[model samples]
Target: MQRRLADNITSDHLSCPICRDTLKDPKLLPCDHSICFECLTQLIESSRRFNKFSCPVDRREITASSYTLSAEQWASSFPTDELSLLLLQTISGDTKTETKLKDGILCSDHPQNGCDFFCFGCYKIICSECAVENHRDTECNCKNFKNCADLAREKLRDAYDEIENLIITGQDIVFKEIDKDQLLLQSRQQIRSTIKKLKTIVQDFEKMINRKCVDILSKVDSVTNVEELKKRTEGIVKDLKRVRDEVELSKSLTSTKDILTVLSKIPESLQKNTDLLYSLAVSDNPIELKLELNEKFLNLCETLIDQPIGTVHVVPADTIDFEDTEATVCSKRIKFSSDVLPLRALELDPFLAIQLDPSESENKITARFTGVIIHGHSIIAIDNANFKVQRFRDTIENQFIDEVLIQGIYDITNIHENDDVLVTSPGKQSRLIRLSTYNSLSIISEKVTENAYFSISQLPDCTFAVISHSSPTSSKKRVNFDWSRGVTSHIDIIDVDGNVLKHFSENFLCEPNEFGDPFIMPLKSICCLPNGNIVVSIETKTNSFISCFNQNARVKWTYDLNDTPEGVCFDDGKIYVFLRESKAVRVLSVDGDLKPVSTLRLPNYFGDGYSLFVGRNLLSVIDRTELIRLYKLQSC
Candidate 1:
């Protein structure tokens, strides 16, 4: 008995219905039917009389309006079925000779059965029968060849494109190097020419000095004395000219062989200094070539004139070192530094204090400050009651430089090496706001959303990650405040423009109210680590924990706070968790062990710690009332 066509050729499904052959650049129509570009073009031409073509499989009218003017253009107007093309490339043994060689390798033990699945564990291919019989264990998980082939083709294409880009990059680098070499040669020639001109100036100065000295000596009463002075001056001029010539020769000895040496010195010449070598290359500072008489000329003038002749004296130029100019501008004090001691060992004594009370001169501060962060030289504080953000100079607590009004300011965080702050607002329409660190009044970027955002953090790449819920802000109620507050069902990773790049949800992970099984602690504060992982402080009425999630929002590890964890922060690979009930800040390592490093007790004035910020080697926290305290971090 003969096998059916479908049984013999597994890729029959990938073939075009009209041509009954493997697809080539298959175009998909509105009816979900795909056909080869060539076949589509022929169908369109045949139906030109009616100005309409129909799908071969669906028999639906394919209007000319749906496609473009030309047949090639019309084919491109529709989406290409890349899956079918990849399938055809895999089974037809065409396009690539490597694919043909790969097809020849069948199942080793069961040669009759084609190897369809790739076992990742054994790093070998196996037939369905063999996979079921020999590799039944989960460790020997197998991937279908059809899917793996498509992935392999995509990876190879990416690698090939990368190599092509590298070739272009390499060519550009070679051309740039060649240009630099030419520039280096030009610099060498210019410097040599300059040295020659300087030598000529010195020779001319020597002749002038000799003539002046002879004229002065001629004033002597004795003719023998005048003659002796002339001989001495002529000898001095000749020696000076010879020295100039020797110096010029020394400069000219820098041949093409010393091109590397010249190139190496190019950076020094470009630096801020009017040295002879630098002046030759740079046009900003002009060189002054002048030769003046030594102290001996002044003595000769005084003696020859007899009546204490008024002599012109040349003063030496002061040497300036460019490196020391910065220090000269302003003297810097010695910076104080000490080893970071354990939180328990160091005292949380109030290093600095600021009153968060409303001021008549500036924008009124809210009774409570929701979020506080020390970004660079400014302390950013969020006023949830007034929907405002206040900026104060970190060094001087009294100076209030700026204030920004946001619609619903929930929390604020600083982006890595960026001057913008990421603020979260859970309002009628939840959104993420990027406010300027300098001028807190302006909004740099805002991403409005339908869901209420709890907290926002910036990844190392400057993209933002926000914890939000699926339900609208209006759905929240005070009666179910605990459940509603912990309603952070999903974490959305978005770009500057607010486009959600990636997101993961807790819905499938667990039901919002369900507990004890798949742990569900609604996310409160979020902080993205230097690594792409995120640390979120999650809490319930009774239970609290700090969970670290990978880029995909999958929980990598979780450390139980035991008490109600309020705010979360990450700095220098350490995770800081604020315990609202315990009235302390717990520092823990993010490693596998999740070891508790140290604990910091809240100060007397701090009623319930709401927010914590760790940056610029300083720690700032917002207290219950109108008080913001700062502490200098020390570790041993």
Candidate 2:
């Protein structure tokens, strides 16, 4: 009881562009359009004839990050469009679903024959004809099956178990949301307390201003006594006039007697007049007052009045209750991993590996690797001792295809949006070299430091962050914590033309710990995360740590470790750090707390871990022992 194809929801998305039919074994192109695997094989073959494989819709060349699989291995190279296939299955008619299962039961080599045997080793269903022809000499445990019923049952059981785990995890997430709500409530109370304290401070300031205004006004009133000053001045003038008249009268009197009396009276009169004049002089000067109103203070008050404090908003918590639990179980597949769900663990295997056998021969490059990066299909490595940058295909059988002989090559990193690689040379005057090709390299940039640069990584803005050891050194040791340790290191962001954009000193680089001591360590490696944060690995006094910094050059968080972290790279919100002593690569989340996601342990014989590059499902690790190992990550 299913809808017919004509009666069903049929749109452009429902049909494949190549076959114009329901998409089968859909393979997605780089442009995001998908077609059947069979159709893609034909398209690839046709494009191969023209020396290019491109998407049919956009005609853009396919340059997937995956290692180039041979012409015969196209099936393994491209990722299957699982979501498209699932959508097609959900919308297709019931007859088509049955036909789809039956289509898998038929053998590709012998369409007339039905596959009755399942090979557990190959994980493929084979017909009797294919079993005798292909599985006869193989080391496989083959079991007879009717129509994949048993296989389907096993898949169903796995799906059921995964669903149950999702149920439990979902419940846990709901409870965690409740905990967040409780924390929010506490934060709301704290905010309210802070607001109340602010109000109290404003009230206290108002009272202080009122007291100051009253005191200043009283001083102004007491100083403005004009009437009292005028009265004192008039009395002093009258007393002075009387003394003058007495002197005149004495002059008119007799000679000797008049002279003696006049002299005595003159002394008394002069003393009295002098006393009165002195009193008047003391009270004569006007009281001056100056009051300059503060323009900034007035503006601030007006601003405060215009934009008074409003009520703080408390964001409501998310609803945790489910509307229909039965519908959730019956409809969509349960989410397992919080990351993408149906919880997956990636199991890594060697897709392509090369243990370079370097011999002293003419026109041969050394295998000593100091740094590594993935450039398109090529895995590029830096030979620090030999001063050579070599490129090799990601395939196991491939040797160094091309190499650039440049003097003083220490490290190599990929540019932000270009295929170009940035090379670092610590002592060389031209510290950074941009490599456009294996044979082409130019000294495009130089480090802005008197000291030697250890490593450099490109930021999103095409600017490079270069690390210097804070002192010139010939020693191989990049980081030292003893008295012999170099001074504070520097992380400077420079443009491609060698212009210093932002220079971060020790004050900006260091992060304070629980004891409030800044973790000022020697910088070893630097890289920018996709989220616009720069991550640097440093060797601390006691151990090692990786610190992530925001765009403002502020430390977002610090991840401490026991082993010394050397080369580091950030991709897809995951940090890849190489542990020098332990010879392992640790992957962690780019969050503030630096949550541990996974770790890959390298063989001891691989030597000390130097650098690591995480490509799309591919990880390339370079070690001090002149070895570069590539791992193919598969989700299980």
Candidate 3:
């Protein structure tokens, strides 16, 4: 008897399907169907025709025509031509399905079995028993269900695409913002570099100027001392000569009466007269180490009388022992300083004149920016750069807390009373850099929005203004322009902490026509007066006049300097204004209603120049054809 595989048997010799195993000592039910005679009888009995399975394999329905086939009938019915190939194909498909089901790592919850269910919530895997056990519990600790987990996995592709697009777009925006910032920074750096060059030239030329002054003063002093001593000596010589001439005349008396009078003189009176004459005419009076003069010296004294001597104060600064390195001098009394052409945000459309048929505002006041100084807890100056200026009060402390190089940037334009620095580092690039004396430097603000040109100014009342202009005004007069106040310019007042307090056009300003309502501050130099009035130096916008307004923001006076005033300050009971074109410093009454009291003359031979007052005492004068003057005000 040969042994064979169970699957090799024909359908006529098929065994029980419930366990797909050979029948043991067979048990026959009353229906005469032989099945497993062990404890699996219940499983076998349920594998019936309507809704049953006699075994775990090949549980397809069994119709009357498919049941009880004879050996010859089964052989004819089964696929014979390609039976082996068809069966192998079926087995391969089943194997693939089983492999896919058990693809991932086995379930930790059911270590002995491969995972057949994917949990959606827990994002893990479990065998059938572990999954059912968790689900049957009221809590259902399973993290994920099979169906839901499939959905989450499908969403990943879409998410990846979205992230890619976002990254590309975000990078473009960041790059563009950085480009803009670098351009502005480069411009500022150029300005600083130009200033530095001029400063060196100014120093050299000023030295020559002071030396010339000292030489002239020296000549005047030399003449004065020599003349004073000679005059005193000459007076004594003249009196002595007069006395000798009188004695000679007396001896040459022509009348006999004078001779008889001389002979008749009493002996006692003669002795007294002789003694006095001797005293007056004595040349060898060793008792008179009193004075000695030769005839040649006397004659020289007479010649000296032709010219007199004078005194002078003009002297070379170099000749004086003046030592001050810190630029802390107040501009109040300084005539020449090192800081000159300090540039800040500005808005100008020289072509605007061509637009409104030359009807545009020729006045400029608000757009012009100046430096501010803040002094107190920490010293900082807000200048052209959009960062705070810092310094070390003590050298050792500075080494411990140096935040950045002052020369690293160019934005320090001004200072405040409290010294919290404000720099013009504008949007994205523009930052109010607060360099701590102890902490690392950081950018305080990030700008999501930007304006065209933001110029800044601060008043004494702790108020600051930002003047910004829109796109350039059209040069074409006939061009359609919505010049209504909003079209050209705007101003904003903000607190020290960057909160917007108010806008210049806050009052419902009526809309305008014709070259658009003159929407500009055009203010160049702003000097806050002790009386609360602001002396704002404005440029000619549309041929407008230079004007000064009261604290109520009222224009009290105006004077067309004709030349633009680049910087302005109050000093010595007067307003000192820097004239760029005129190359001069103009002094006016504090009210801005007077003529220049005095002008400090600069030698055009060297070069044209300008100056800005840094603090209460220091003046930074620059832009000279040859020299710059770092003038520190001296206490008179």
For model 2, the superposed segments whose C-alpha errors exceed 4 Å read 1-347, 361-366, 428-430, 438-451, 472-487, 511-521, 580-582, 591-594, 603-606
The per-prediction CA RMSD against the true structure, in angstroms, equals: 33.8, 28.5, 29.9
TM-score of each: 0.41, 0.41, 0.31
Worst 10 residues of 2 by lDDT: 336-345
* Candidate achieving the largest lDDT: 2
Position 326, candidate 2: lDDT? 14
lDDT of 3 at 279: 41
Query: What TM-score quantifies how close candidate 2 is to the native fold?
Result: 0.41
Ordered from best to worst lDDT, the candidate numbers read 2, 1, 3
Q: Which TM-score value belongs to model 1?
A: 0.41
Displacement of the residue 86 alpha carbon in candidate 1, Å: 99
Model 1 over residues 1-636: C-alpha lDDT tens digits? 113432344344556788887677888787767788888888777765455777778688876664348776666688776444544444444555244346756678966455667776676777654665577575874556655777557757988999999999999999878755664565567567877897898689789988987876664433334466566656655655565565455567657655555556545543523243332333454444334657887896688678632343332212111111110001232222211222222246666667755766366754467788877777778767777787888888657878877776787777667687778888766787877766445787887765666667778887888777553255444223346454446788887666788877754332245555454666667788877987777654555666666786456665554567777778876777777765777776655544555666545644666667877667777754567788776551
By summed lDDT, the worst window of 10 consecutive residues in model 3 runs over 347-356
